[model samples]
Target: MSNTAQELKAEILRLTRDYSALVHRANRAGTENSVPFEPGKTTVPYAGRVFDQDEVEAAVGATLDFWLTLGPEGEAFERELAGFLGVKHSLLVNSGSSANLIAIAALTTHKLPANRRVQPGDEVITVAAGFPTTVAPILQVGAVPVFIDNDPATGNARVEQLEAAFSPGKTKAVMMAHALGNPFDLSSVLEFCRRHDLWLIEDNCDALGCTYSMPIARANALGIIENSPGIPANGTHVTRYTGTWGDISTQSFYPPHHLTMGEGGAVNLVSRPPLKTYAASFRDWGRDCWCASGKDDTCGKRFNWKLGELPRGYDHKYIYSHLGYNLKPLDPQAAIGRQQLKKLPAFIEARKRNWEVLREGLAEFADKFDFTLPTHATGWTPEGFTWDATGCRTECSWFGFMLRVKPGAGFTHTDLARHLESKKIGNRMFFGGNLLRQPVFVQLRKDRPSSFRVLGAMPGADEIMERALFLGTYPGLTTTMLEYELQVIRDFVRQA
Candidate 1:
């Protein structure tokens, strides 16, 4: 407001820009040489931040603006990303876990009929082999999570299990991942949702660009078919890209995920009416006002309306709508996301190409490893590489691969995993092996007889997951990195 304050702010802005420029220069200087992957020495990451100078520059540029919270960049990223996903609204959040929480929480709004909200103790069916965030939100909302055993070979939930999960008025929603880019029988899931009137949330965090045949929830609560497979939004039973299917789907922008907003994630919602779209408002700030971050009084009479028990002319901005959380991601994250979006098509293509290469290269060892490749039916595209095997095995990706050793294969998973780690070929145990068996599910298990049930016994779920590991095909991987990983497994298997 004062002359000195304005001048000081201008000077601070100048210094911030200068600092960012210096950091960019330093990062570029350090990246001049190619880094090679050395077995037993180099860390073959499952996934790592895949970025360049441009991404860093964009992020720092946002930082210099000092609009550190969700601002123009965040709004722009949400619009551009929603357009990319063929969805109506996209809300950027703090993380994938929060995205899941928001999406599920939005569905529980009183705006929908009381029965429609995922009531406490109501069952939300999901697989036991997925990332914890996928199912954590279920219990976090006080809804019972009915675990289903995944198809071990495909690492996807058995579509046939849905009918069982829904039997006798049990399920309120069905949520699951495409499972490492593999499309998980979306057709069946959607049809099941339609038949049961269950809400479907696709955890497309790992499978961003991927698509499967399904109807996109349109303006009328009507599922409209798409004419073109990859085109944005057109009207047939066309492919619903992974992030576009759910009534409210979500994606992670964490560095290791499909795209990096550093520490960001997003919730994608498709509402039948614009009024319903305001439902997400509560999630953002529980505000009665629907104006953009810095704007005011889009409703034209911000202080004229009488809402709740407040005075006759209350400030609309402070009116709380839905009980919500401050889970929004920062503008810098969105700035990075804008840069990442440009590289997404290339990233997805690289992942597909790398998967094919690994598939071909490991064909000879298929017998020994029992590697099962995902079968993408016509009109489907995958996002990542996921394969499991029965023995002293080796698989490849752009960055990491799996080393699943079956009991009958003359080696234990422990032995094979130890060998790979000792050789410096990085690996990770499959995400929360038998998630139901984990401690988080301890409370849920006690009432399993009355409140929940697994669609089937999950001994195979525990066995296969414990015996499997996930590596990366993320863009950060180099040829040398993949080659060394392949050789490590090849050498280990030869001994077996």
Candidate 2:
């Protein structure tokens, strides 16, 4: 590039920074006491994008480059994210829903041995109380989703039911999310999967910074090493991030997620190289070639591959390996992600602090409602945690503060939710609560009753569906906002 071009690029970047500062000023000024916390007036969102000039500038800089597709920014973001999560590889996708889809679809690839590959009609153990997308991929792949109950207190799958949900040689995988950023019982789930030789896919989209401690042997078996510089070197167990505990895990980078890339997600390859290849193939148009976008012939003999009865010297780039989708985010989105990633540690800390404040502030009303705090296999208290018998532990990066209206309480879930809404305080039900009760499942059951299986009646799941809701613990929630929310809740409970 000539000196004139270099100067022009610098000017463009400087102008972008100036524009970004203006945006930041406008955003802050607009939101500053914009609406007083009067009933039915102020709106406190349950989740939202919390960003500043850096993210805007990065995005504008990438747009100026005009490399619209996944490129250098995407590659760097992927590496940085994988390193943050202590995982081997992270393949970017268009959305968390697509990440879940590709993660499951990759398991069905022929790259795995026939015995290990998830075949059509095989069962995948999952919970039915959370988001639909977490379970949708199993059905999409023509596999049966074996439904299990969720623990109302934690809003996670009931781990004790693992054995009941298992079917030897028939249940091929276990795919579930860490509900609302609270991790499930990774110890029991890992043990169950290992015992049964089933694949594990942790939907880590909601719990990116959460940590779980497991026996070293088990962690190593899943290809996780506890080697962070600051963490204590305990020889017996390894404390790995939630995303690294499974054969495959996923992350969402939507505006409301832990990090924001506007609309992006990633399928993390935690255990196997072949799984990475398969997932990448599925993401990159199902082609046999491993080449990045706009590049070719990474395999050297791109014209000399013949696996599926095509001409012997057919171009490898066009060879369809598995049925797949083009689910990739743009380079500009990834550039924003790179900036967001730098802010993630602070964001996670803010979330944790906000949750603690809510927990503490609402302790007085604990008798009125069941506060759903994060739990682990090990019992926890404010002072410290007691390790489970196997020495397993969990550290959560909470996504929200869940509250379940206790049975026999004067106020019902609907009553409290309505009151919160009337106060313009945002809240959310556990996503698709009791998903089996959803219309789609009801219709499926009515039409083809054999499509999915359920374990014994899901009373716990019913409890959550009837009583559970959550409030924002995202980094965007300021102390003033939380105090106002607390006051609103206090007023509602006292009146009730």
Name the top lDDT candidate.
Answer: 2
Write candidate 2's Cα lDDT for 358-453 as tens digits. Answer: 888888886788877565544335564455465567777888889899877799988988888888889988889999999999999999798899
On the 0 to 100 scale, the lDDT of residue 104 in model 1 is: 80
Task: List pairs with backbone clashes in candidate 1.
Answer: 225-236, 286-321, 390-406, 400-472
- Give lDDT tens digits, candidate 1, residues 1-496: 5898668766665665567555544222113244534556877666766666557667767776779888899999988888888787788888988888887877766667765677778888888887899988887777877888877665778777788778546578888876777667765676788877888888877778775544344312436454223455544235556666557788888877777887888888754444234445645676777777788998899989898898978999888767777787788889989988877877776666655555555555654664544533221123444323311111111222443565576666778778878877666766787887787676756755455567768865786676777666766556666777777777777778
Candidate-wise lDDT, in order: 0.69, 0.85
Off by over 4 Å in 1: 1-33, 167-170, 214-222, 227-237, 271-279, 375-403, 447-452
- Which ranges of candidate 2 are over 4 A from the true structure? 25-41, 215-230, 234-236, 377-390
Using all chains and alpha carbons, the TM-scores for the candidates as numbered come to: 0.84, 0.94
Please give the lDDT score at residue 143 for candidate 2.
91
- Candidate 1 C-alpha RMSD relative to the actual structure: 5.9
| TM-score, model 2 to reference | 0.94
- Each prediction's Cα RMSD? 5.9, 2.5
Q: With candidate 1 superimposed using the best TM-score fit, by how many Å does residue 154's alpha carbon deviate from the native?
A: 1.4
